[model samples]
Every structure is written in C-alpha cells, then in structure tokens.
Target: MTHSTRSSHPRRRTTPRHPVSPRGLRTLRATWERQAAEAGGPGGFHHLHGPHTHGWLLADAVPELLEPIVHADDDPLEPTFFAHLDAPVAEALLARFAPAHLVHRSNGSPTLGNQLRATVAHPGEITLHGFVLGPGRCDERLVSEGALVRFEADLLVTEHHAPGCECELLWAYAVDELGLDDAEHAPHRIHRIHRAEAPDETWWRLLWA
Candidate 1:
C-alpha cells in the first residue's frame, strides 16, 4: 500500500507575466544601441544630416562625384560603401532608414505604436529582446509574442521624432531585407533633444516676456 502526504503550506500568488515579442525587440535593440554612440565621436548627429550628410563628403552635395566612385552600376550603393545620394534622393532615402528600422515595413510605415509608446514612457534605459534573423530576410522573419520596452531619458527626445521617423525606421529593415546588412559597419548616433524646455518656453511667453 502507498501512503499520500499533503502539506499544510499556504498558497502564494504568482506574479503576472508580461510577454515580450521577439520580432519587435529587433528594432528596439538597434535604437538602444545608439545611446553608447559617444565612443564613435561627434559627427554622429551631423553625419546623419547637415552640411556634411553623406560619407563621400562632396558627394552629398554633388551626386556627380559618386557616379565614378560607385563601381556597381545597378545597385551603385549596395549598403556597404557610403557615397553621396542624389540630393534628390538623399532626404527620402535617409528617411526610409531612420529611427529603429525593424519597426517599419518595406514602404517605410510604422509597424508598432503601443511598443513605441511604452518605450517613450520610460527614458535612458532599454530592454533587450530575443529574436533572430530568419532566412536572412529582414521583412517578417522576426518571431515575437510582444516587444519589450526600454526607458532612456536623454537631454532631448530622439531626433527620430519627425515625419521621417516612420520612413527611416522602415528603410533599415528594407536594407536588411535587401540583404545589405554587412554593407556599412560604421557607428551611427541617434540625436536626442530635450522637451522640457517646450513647456517652460510656453509658460514664459504666456506670463511675462
């Protein structure tokens, strides 16, 4: 005969779990990585856009200079070498790859809002997620239950706050989709600008001078 024993211990409630999606995290990681950009140097912000926007220096202003340097005729700039973009395409192309990338689709549309909102709620810190590239395609290979959120409070909100934010966020994934991930290895900085001043500025104007 076997005897069964029951313990009189009190039952404890388990903590609620918030599942994170592996797909959304891929883009989150890229954005958080920009925080450590101090090591790469200053131009991080300027290089992104300014007098000197492209890698080939004069190429950004004058696309003609890049035609010769860009050896590949079909896909002249295949993600690796940074030449100059046609002044015409420069703005559009960069916007296509701005923000975090993975969160955007091929046409450069945002794929997530709740995740982005959660991220903005907390600043200065980031949460890493689990997701791997599939079939080497950046499109829909990501597998996530839900994206994790990281809070990083910078002097300013990320420069990715404009209309380009949506497009740029998408382009990176497209490049990854195009299998151009290994093209450029250089470090890039995400611009951070403060928003606190906005409220103060508004108050000052409404009150005195």
Candidate 2:
C-alpha cells in the first residue's frame, strides 16, 4: 500500500542499445572474475575502483524506509522511487541493512574532499534488473522482493565537459523476502558498480561487448 511521492519520468528502454553476443557475455564474466581476483577479490576491486559503488539490503526494508515514495501500483518489487537521499539517512539505512559480507568502499582521503555522496542524475532514466546467485553461478531472476537488484541510471555527466557527456551508472543490492530454503541463495551484499564522473572502462567494454 506504500505510495511513491516522486513524479514520473521517462523509463529507459529495457533492451540494451548494443546487445552483447553470447561469447561476449562469457568474456565479460571472465574479465570480471579476473579483475576481482587480481584486485584481491570483489571486495578489493570495489575499494580500488572510483567513487561509484553499490550494496545489498533486505527487501523488506525498502518499503519501510521508502514507503512514502514507493508505490505498489506497479510490481511492488519494481516500484520506482527517488534515488537521491540525504547523506546521514543513506548511511544509516545502508548500515542497518548491510549483510555480514558487505565490504564498504574506501571514501579516499578526507583532505581531498572526495567522499561519496548520495546524488542522482536528474533529467534521466532509472532501470532495475534482477538476478539470483549461488555458490559458483548466477542466473537472471524475475524482478521480485526476494531477488538481487541491479540499479542503473543513464544521465548527463557535466562535471568536466562544457557540453555534458551522457553516461551510465550502476550498482546492486540483494534481498531475501521469500524465505527460500536454499542454502545458496544470493548473498546479501551491496556494491557501487560504476559512476558517471569516473566510468570504469572495463564495464563499458562489457556493455558493448
């Protein structure tokens, strides 16, 4: 019964503009594994990466925290809500919902003032994808409260460009609302996968691969 307060905006096309071939998908997954291994596993890679990040949370918390702005008009699991959030509130929410294996990215030096902030691209689109992960495999899952959520946004990057560049940003989190009895259900982890200000070349390659 929760209602979303944010006004509607254009939804991004579900299909990728440049779809990856089956081989490309394999290569992309391999590269991700290699990068993760080299960087001391996924936790290390996330830390070494730039400011963009993602994380996991219990699906139930989504309604509790964002009830005012997460309407049930659509698939409750795919409810659209505001991405921008207050810094303290964002931090507290993450802390409360984070799983034991959730490794937070380093915010870099305080003197440089490069801390991660909760901001979103306005005049753009937001999209979500769902997946399920087991010990050594991952498979797409229908968008649901119990599935892992991949949150992505396409927005303009104006920081260093007179004419802003359009780019994609991504992050992910997991939820377990189904009480699935499987021991290998996806882990509850959240990670910031990419940022517009500093895009990861590898991620771009994978997208276009």
Candidate 3:
C-alpha cells in the first residue's frame, strides 16, 4: 500500500466582472503609491492627459473606489464653468467621493473641449484607461461602450470664459507664463514649474486661482 500526500495550496480566483481593466487598475494604483511617496505634507492631486481623456487623480489616507463618473451629456466647456459654482450635481458628486479618490474624464479635442472638460471635472477615470492603453484606443473603447459621445462643436469651443471659471487663467498661464503653445504639453511644463526656485506671484495666482 502506498500513501499519497495532497498539496495545501489554493487556486487564485479571478474577477472577470470588474468594470475597469487590470492594466488600468495597476497603473492607477502605482500612480497613487508613487504620488503618495513623493508628496509632502497632505497628499495632493496629480493631472493626466490621454489622447481621448484628461483629468486629475488624488492621493490621500483613506482609499475610496467608485465607478468612473461619466459626464457624457453635459457641455464640457460652458457647463463646467457653472458646475463648480454652487451646483447641486457637482456638490453631490464631491460628497460621494472625496476629491482625493475621484476620477474624472471627458471627450473633446486636446486644445479645447477635452482640456476644459478635465479642468472642470476636478476635485477627477477614463483617465486611468487613457493612461494604460493610450488615448486613441481608450477613446474607441469608451465610445463603443457608450461611455462617451462625440461632438464636432467641441473643437470650436473657446478657452476664455467667465472670470471666476479659471479656464482663462489656465490658458494664460500655459501660453504666457509657461510659453506653451499646446495644452498637451502641460505635464512637462508643470515639471519645469515645480523645479523653478522662485516662480513669481503670477504663477501662484494662475495656479490657485
């Protein structure tokens, strides 16, 4: 008679029903950890720009995970200015997810609609997808899944808006102070801004304004 021994290891389970891709999750998690390690004082936010989407990601103590808040219906340019201005929907969105954990993304051209959309969707996941797969493919997936709808007019939207909106200020800073022609270059320019020893008062005003 021979005795047989059984292995004690258990098989790992997979979640096929997860809404976001594994790559996206990993990218987001890694980004969060990196930002957390690099951040000083309270953890702050980081910005991302994908071919089809752009938005902010925050690092904080408590992690809050939620579905990517899709804003496919709203006008990415005009409505965004008012959305942050005492709007109930915006308030509710913030209340659900702390600004640190929220992910926001929008559709439009890199210069106009998309930039403004990312700007307003703050305090902001399609952003994660964009980072993982690059902008073009991410946009295709979102569009096929009905998470985004295309608007030709988004390209025509202007950068300048109401004074309190901050869009104009951002545009001015990027163009004037940073001397960047394209909004797509903001991340690189931001690094330069960070490395500067004495970035002047205008830099502060445009950034925090």
Candidate 4:
C-alpha cells in the first residue's frame, strides 16, 4: 500500500528539431540524419546560421551570458511578427504563411552572421510585437491572404504600445552574435536563459498581469 501517490499521468513533451552544435555534435548528428531524410519531416530543417547553429553556442565565456527568458506572452523568444517585405516581397509572402508559427530572431549569433529580429504576436484584441514591421497588415490572414513569411533576421526587439503605460522596449539583437562570456546549454541545444527576474508592469499592469 505504499503507493499513496498513484493515479499518475502527467509528462509528455518532446520537442527537439535539429540542434547540435557542440563543435558539430558528431557532425551535427550526421547532418541531421541527412537533413531529416531530405526534408521529409523534422520541421523543414534549417539552422546553418552561425558556424552551424551558434558555433557551440559560443564555446566558452564568463560574462552575463545568455539573457532573455520571458515567462508569459508566449515568450518563446518572441519574434516573427513581420512586415517590411524585402526579398522578392518575402517570397510572395510564403504562399499564405505555409502554416506558420515563425517567431523570428536569429542573426545567427555565436557571433552574429545571419542577424535576426522578429516580433509578430497575433491572437486578437490587438496584440502586436513589431506589428509585422508595421506599414500595413492589420490582419486579413496577414495582408489579404499572406499569413506571414519573410525571413532574414537581424535586429532585436520592437515596440509601439505607446500611450505611455508600459512598453519597456529594449532592442539588442545580434549582441555581437551572442558571444556569451559564460555559457552553458548544450544538452542538445535548446535555449532561453535569464532564469528569473520579471517584475515591473504598467501597460494595464502588463495587460492584466
């Protein structure tokens, strides 16, 4: 009867889509198993940004390394909000966002090569992170059918929650390609540091805390 803690069932989440950069972890897992079997799945595959996904996430350093670790607001490193259609109008707007989730930002740090900056948070009731780079698209499937698709990151944050309540925007992209002075996070590459520290709201108490 020592099972006072039975009826259990709560643990299911495995998300690892190509991320091996410990100096090319076994040649990047054999080139991500041959690019996920020639892009059959494994999420399209594409992280050759830095010396191949952040050159071992910046080998070794020792200064305030790896920041940013937001809690809510989906905080997945928030980015991918879009607009400034450049590269061939962003590939005809990714043929209707091609089922997207994006969340951009990746000048490919490890010393900034690809350069990134994305912020597109859309749900409803007005929420805009870089509001799709502004200049248009208030939502219509993201400009009349183009959900959102335009990569080539390299910037850092973005804001416009004006009316002065709380918009502590801080831009700092390609932080010298995130050459962390002291790093860690190589259990197969997955980042989002900062750990703790988030208490200062305003914009309606951070949109209702």
Can you write out model 3's per-residue Cα lDDT over 148-174, one digit (the tens) per residue? 111112122223533444334444444
Model 2 off-target regions past 4 Å? Answer: 1-62, 99-209
**RMSD to true structure for each model, in Å:** 23.7, 19.5, 20.3, 21.1
Model 3: C-alpha RMSD to truth?
A: 20.3
Q: 1-209, model 2: which lDDT tens digit per residue?
A: 11142123212323212233355333323333343244343544232334322222222233234332232222212223333233333333333332222222112111101111121111112222222221121211112121112234444434332354442222211112212222232223322345464353221110100
lDDT string, candidate 4, 1-209, tens digits? 11222224211232222333366223422332343244334343333441112112111110001111101122212222432223222222222122221223222211111111111121111111122211011111122111122212322322343364122221112112222211111111111212122223111101100
- Model 1 alpha-carbon drift over 4 Å, by segment: 1-113, 124-128, 138-144, 147-209
Q: How many steric overlaps does candidate 1 have?
A: 25
Off by over 4 Å in 4: 1-25, 38-209
Q: What is the lDDT of residue 88 in candidate 4?
A: 27
Candidate models: Cα lDDT each: 0.25, 0.25, 0.26, 0.21
Clashing pairs in 2: 4-69, 5-69, 53-192, 54-190, 54-191, 54-192, 55-190, 55-191, 56-189, 56-190
Better of 1 and 2 by lDDT: 2
Evaluate model 3: give its lDDT.
0.26
- TM-score for each model: 0.17, 0.22, 0.19, 0.15
Query: Any idea how many clashes model 2 has?
Result: 10
Q: What shift in Å separates residue 144 of candidate 2 from its native position after superposition?
A: 17
